[model samples]
Target: MLDLLVIVILLSLVVMTNRRLAYANETIHAKWLEQNLNRLLAYHTAFSFLFPLLPGDASGYWGFTLQQVTVHSNNMFDYFGLGTPFLLFLDFIPVKVMGLSFLTGNIMYGLLGFCGLRYLFLLYYKSLNLDILVFGVRTVPFLFYLPNLNFWTAGVGKDTLCFFGIACFVYGIQFYRRRIISMALAAALVYFIRPHVAFMMGASLAICVVFSGRMKAIYKILFLALVAAGAAVVYKQVLGYLRIEDLSTKSLSGVASDTAGLLEQGLTGSAVDIQSYPLPLKFFTYLFRPLFFDVHNVLTLVSSFENLAYLVILIKALPNLRRRDIGAMPMWMRTGLLIFLFAMVVFSSSLGNLGIIMRMKNMTMIYLLMYCTWSISRRKAELAARATLTHN
Candidate 1:
């Protein structure tokens, strides 16, 4: 317990130190926005307490969730990846030592989230190794304080670890570029938590390698072949994790038919049958669904606003799209965007529920936003250059 408390205190201090640095580095509005985001994170943590207890709850209190975690920790490997069990034990420390409940644990997780995001920024800066900032000033804080990202990742669940894992993987990619040791660890961590997400990240990394331009053509082909082989090796395991049964027996049309049937069954009548839809519609549903028209509750309404923001961001990025040549863009930027689009297509095509899609896409949305921000920044620089030339 003392050790856990000490660790928590250390995390708090890290956040405090970084908080000062953020205020110094960011604009007043950005700092204010961050503070409000912190508050919203707290509010969301508090709000989660109101969620109804899971079934078979004997403990009229917070122990129900923890108890389940304890009971299921040992069997976690049988179902999810080893990551779930790992997080369960890690989360259990506070509860066992300090007698903390789910809500309190979530608060601590939120704090950890701040620390993780702070470290991610640090890693990003280190990778850039630049004195002069090249990206938009608002981009860093905006991604850090992204509402849904914080909301979902702040909880004491697999999502939190998954978020951390992605941050770790990205950090590893940025700093350790040639050495994938760190990235492998991050991937392994997330593989335990969510294998499908890990697979997507793996696919994205492969895409990055293809775009890197550092590798010879033969090596690129070889690398892609290896990635395909790896995917083949793990494909069945991923399908099993996804609970997609009998896929081997199904053709593409058969799979689509099954998906349509599942969507029709729906979750509280909230599912959409995207299997019958075209690619564009599927992408729209995945990226921009739960719009104002789809808002049936407070949560969806809040999400609708976020969706609207995505729409606005997409529109802003569209004009600058022509300015970007995929092959000419920096490897990391193009890779991140490709990963996001690939993941979006994968999710939007098969996913049935808006809420689930929103939550799941949290993994890739940061990369998507990063690409959009870069496009916007490039456009601004181009305009500035043009204005100077015009004056001359």
Candidate 2:
């Protein structure tokens, strides 16, 4: 436990030191020293390379740490290479070839984020101003604090990619309002990134088009259905083929994931013991638990703080709930919020415990951010429309 605490501290200090540097270098995320610099420049500082690569496994593979590649070193021979286990995918190359290690992987991961966020900002530019970019920037703070993000976003997971797809779908809808031809193509591109999500987005797009109330636009419903069905079919076929390939070729390939193996066993065993523990009965506790969250990497508990932030925003937003009528918000905003909320609730339903809420809270943070961003943007749009009408 002492060693764990020390590692966490090292992580905290590294983040503190590099926090400002990230803004300055714009790419401070790349662990320069870890890259095995063949030729150091006159202005290059050695700490640049070493600091981001320091050992910090509590962060899993993507945390600021050196020798971080070993976190998934076991998977070096998955051979199938169809898709990397979440963490292994990102760490696969950057950590080896370019030495992009911890911070750098995230910066690259953030590029996926940038794609999504940039799309949103461009679409909502009239409402989402420069201040909203700060919100986009803040996801970094949230990302750094999650031990899971190390692997989920940077190492090899699809969360960033998923968000990118969602953002593209939204942008496509807005574009379809004016440029119908491009809508099918934009929607199809997001689908290629993560077909499952793209299918869902396509469904939502269909619904939006159906109710858009423009008789001339009703034909879009068919286009959306064809697109949604096509994307889903492609995704299913690809995933199925990959799984079959894995069984035949990589059957013996996954044997190297020693750590993941142990973790899987421990999870299975503990799940059996869950009912025996007093945890399930401690239900109400986690709802407000983070205040004193200290034991398991307290720094990673930024998720709890994010939840708190959501609640505060909810409190401030209570006034809007007073009118208690559906017509209060714009049609697009209301419909989008409902679909986004549905996706979130469906996603969070899987996490079923308290003491272990640490992992689950990550999902909540993501959903809450999505919700808050939408809410703020919605209000801005409503205000702008009212102003335009008043002036006219």
Candidate 3:
């Protein structure tokens, strides 16, 4: 009886929010997609919240494990200790109490992505004079249809962590420029959730800031260094709990072995095997491949052109920059982009993880950077044309 009340309440809430939802080009959130993604998030969040923390050594035997960082001060978070890890807090929480697991994580992820989009649009608005707000407003359709984000972040997975990480990094750039304490705190939350991405994002922003010809290069390096230190601390704590012996040092090539084993089990189609692959890879393959997402090859390439979009837009906008007309750019806009670029260079490590999550590492910044730059440039053009018209 109570279940019915919950459903009715949820439905009414959705109806209320529906009118306010951004609907680019008149596309609506598909029902099947929403429910399926919600289920995935709920399952994981429930699991994360309830599961007890195992001793570091104990996690090594199975697919779920964390390396306890031996080199660390007394720390509050143990989630970093994991190598081939599991969700720390979110995984145990909702799963045990409500049998929720991945679904809750996914929901959080979606909200984070939405927040990221909003932040990026705001930055784009400040950077250039384009219709990015409109473009961003229209981006709703793409985000709604973005199944990978909808399903993964919408559930109890690292994708949402990634979403949060990327979004907060943008805020960090803002803080770095304004010298705000809240921005650093905001980034700390993301690193707490997903340490790997912390460095990746920090580096990228350093590059963006330095190259935009506005920020002091020294501050960019220092800012990135601080974030790196924070990430190392988080990694040390997490590994101290889980037991990651080495990253630059060699471990087993067990990555391929682990993946094969997962596939082997998945082939059985057990009741526990609700979906196909475990996360990291599951989300990537589904997003980039033809068999799953089912878009035309050209459209697929275009849609998947997350990071590459910047190269295209930069080519179109460099002439404008050369003319010394980079209007509305705060000194930090350049810093943010520089850091994002540098992260792609020095920190991203999914390449060696047997291609598991390799593709996702830097992709978050790609779309964010692309749309923001493109919109900013277009807005600048609008302002320029308007000024000329006024003079006439």
Candidate 4:
């Protein structure tokens, strides 16, 4: 009854805010995509929830230990220390309380993803001072309606958590300067959910602090030095938590090689020889593979088109990437883009599975999309200003 009452209230709010939602998209496709993605996630949850419930199930779905581990064991840190169990722990609640139905658990994830998306957009807009509602612009729709980002992230899994964590980190840094508690909370999310990403984000933040002209050199150096020391401590802690021994560079490469070998063998149909590629090539593949020619299915086909669209924007922006142009960019935007680029190179080198790649790309792609949007908006403002001056 309580759940039903909550749903009723949410529905009422949706109806009341229908006009505002319409303003979010000019066409119904983005709206429909959100609804459909939620339904798809629910259907997936319905099918997937059964695997763990069945006796002798050993498929290892979503990184959980089947029925043996309950939601109470989520933060047990010792038993389930590695891999992503936070999202599974979240799903466990609705399943335990509301009878494990798709409507209950998956709809909850759907709403979580939706909130994640909104938070992501807020991070971008606020960081760049972007106007999503520029009078005649249609480009904002792509940010909301990108199929792979929506479909993969709008589900009950680590992708949703990644989205939520990265968004929170960006928001905290961009908006709540000097607010250590908020930033720490956001960093904690990223650390627990994806520790390497937390490190990457921390690196970007430190770089931003060091290079920022607004602060005194001594202050910047002191802050950066403190941050670097903290990151080293956190890195050691993360290594200990994961129980991974051997901190040598050779061991790191071995791990990446072994992971690549498994991805090549395990992820049938999406396998590629990532082990053969150099680092730069791996980065390129990570950012822009599954190209139009590489499309083997409807999903990849759609992704190809999205890639093509973004590629055009990148091509146009490349020549304009002058030192002055970069200097003109907001500090947070510069930090976010560098973080995205660095994270992509890291993830791409380590991961070879196309499905995983598709899901993980959402973490960085939002920043790129926002950078493009901001660039376009800034150019238009410049043109409008010049026209006004000429007329005057």
Question: Which candidate number maximizes lDDT?
Answer: 1
How high is the CA lDDT of each candidate model?
Answer: 0.60, 0.41, 0.42, 0.59
TM-score of each: 0.71, 0.50, 0.51, 0.74
- Per-residue lDDT of model 4, residues 252-322, tens digit only: 44454454554354445665677678988887677776787777777678777777766766665565345
Query: Candidate 2 residues 1-392, lDDT tens each?
Result: 44345334544554444444334433542354212111111112222233244233323544324342334343445422322233455455555544544544444554444444444433332233222322344322232232332223332234555655555556555545675555555455444443334444555556655655553654765666676677655754645633433322122122212223333432321122222325433332333334334324433365456545555555544553434333433333444554454443332232333323433333224433444554554565567889999999
* Candidate 3 segments whose C-alpha is farther than 4 A from its true place: 1-86, 101-105, 125-128, 132-152, 175-182, 192-194, 203-328, 331-336, 346-363, 366-368, 371-391
Candidate 3 residues 265-338, lDDT tens each? 42221112213445544333422332313333443343445313334444544544532333345544544544
Q: Per-residue lDDT of 1-392 in model 1, one digit per residue for the tens?
A: 55457546755675466567556546745566346445544554443344333221212222435332445433323323343345655644455546765556656665555545654554333222122222333554454555676666655666566767777676666555564677777777777776666776777778788767667899789878977887788778767745675333223224334443443443464677767888788888888878989888776888888877777777777887764356555554555566577666556667777877776677667667666656666667777788999999
TM-score of 3: 0.51
Which pairs of residues clash in candidate 1, taking residues 3 or more apart in a chain or in different chains?
83-192
Q: Can you rank all candidates by lDDT, best first? A: 1, 4, 3, 2
Q: Report the poorest 10 consecutive residues by lDDT, candidate 1.
A: 53-62
Q: Give the range where candidate 4 is weakest over 10 consecutive residues by summed lDDT.
A: 52-61
The best candidate by TM-score is: 4
Per-candidate count of clashing residue pairs (backbone under 3 Å):
1, 10, 83, 0
- Winner on TM-score between 1 and 4 is 4
Give the lowest summed-lDDT range of ten residues in model 2. 34-43
What ranges in model 1 sit over 4 Å off?
1-10, 16-92, 96-98, 119-140, 177-180, 215-269, 323-330
Q: After superposition, how far is residue 293 of candidate 2 from its true place, in Å?
A: 6.2
Clashing pairs in 4: none
